[model samples]
Target: MAGQTFDLTDDNKILSLRSPKASISGPYKVVFKNIEERWAIVAIDWDGEPRLAIRWFWGNGGNPFSSGNPTWLVIPSSLSNATLNGLPLDFKLYSKLVDFLAGKITGDQIYI
Candidate 1:
């Protein structure tokens, strides 16, 4: 997914995931506590929405996915520190995530 780009002009615009047909739309927040731990709390305003939050832990090497209603998309990886809604996050990883969410890339390409 390298070299691919996405238009995030609208901060409130959301994108959908392919396989499970999950749609992520609205203003969301991402928080990265450390390089090995991170999580995203997303607002669910769509019909049949699966999860409302996303979590990540690098030590386990697990892929991020929706766990429950008002759900959480958990991702396991080490993401650099950056910012989200004035909070810190991994910009690199965040970029990839934007692409993935925009349908410009696949889940496999979400990591650095």
Candidate 2:
């Protein structure tokens, strides 16, 4: 693996992501699907180092910021329905944040 930096930004109706590669090549593609058909591809900022840029839809109109630790991120729409290691996210959180987000429990509630 190589060291890389990734950033997600916004366009008029799509989200833009920029990626760069220092010493890599061959087959390259965006990380997510539905990029061209569902969303418009805008400008790609490659003025700096070896880089990759992509643009995609910004659906339903919601803030994309996160308010938790870096280890955890607010799930994006493109990934909301995606499974992790073959398990749906809802099941993954059921024993933890699911109850909190569903209002079935609170921070003071104990499950153990």
Candidate 3:
């Protein structure tokens, strides 16, 4: 954790993640996946700093700025307001944002 800055950018894609009981090593993994629609999110606490990678499928007849493939982003959760690809944290993502800010993983806390 020496050289790892707290910046939200620079997603290392290293999906290998650490569980509370497991040690984090090699490539890290995710928090959750197959999110609402056209989007998916994964989180990793690199050396105890929580971060998320939001991926979205831009299947819009090949957008000019992109190849129309799913794009991945590592954004800031510390800002007063956060936006994903210029989108507000509203709509279906609102609930997910709440969980992210509160450091709660809803899917992992459920008891069958």
Candidate 2: residue pairs that collide: 19-52, 20-51
Model 2's alpha-carbon lDDT is: 0.27
C-alpha positional error of residue 63 in candidate 2 after TM-score superposition, expressed in Å: 19
Model 1, poorest ten-residue lDDT window? 1-10
Per-model TM-score, in order, reads 0.30, 0.20, 0.31
Better of 1 and 2 by TM-score: 1
Off by over 4 Å in 3: 1-27, 45-49, 60-71, 79-112
Worst 10 residues of 2 by lDDT: 1-10
* TM-score, cand. 2: 0.20
Which lDDT tens digits does candidate 3 get at residues 12-108?
4323212222322222333343323434345444334445555443344211122322223544566413543344434455555455446674333
Residue-pair clash count for candidate 3: 7
**After aligning candidate 3 to the native by TM-score, how far in Å is the CA of 12 from where it should be?**
16
* lDDT for position 17 in model 1: 25
- Residue lDDT tens for model 2, 34-108: 433432222121332122223333443212222321111123333322322233334434344334334465433
Task: Give lDDT per model, in order.
Answer: 0.35, 0.27, 0.37
lDDT of 1 by residue, 1-112 (tens): 1001211222222223222335444323332332324323442223332223443333233235334222335222222122233444467866665555445765445446
> lDDT of model 1 at residue 73?
50
RMSD of 1: 13.0
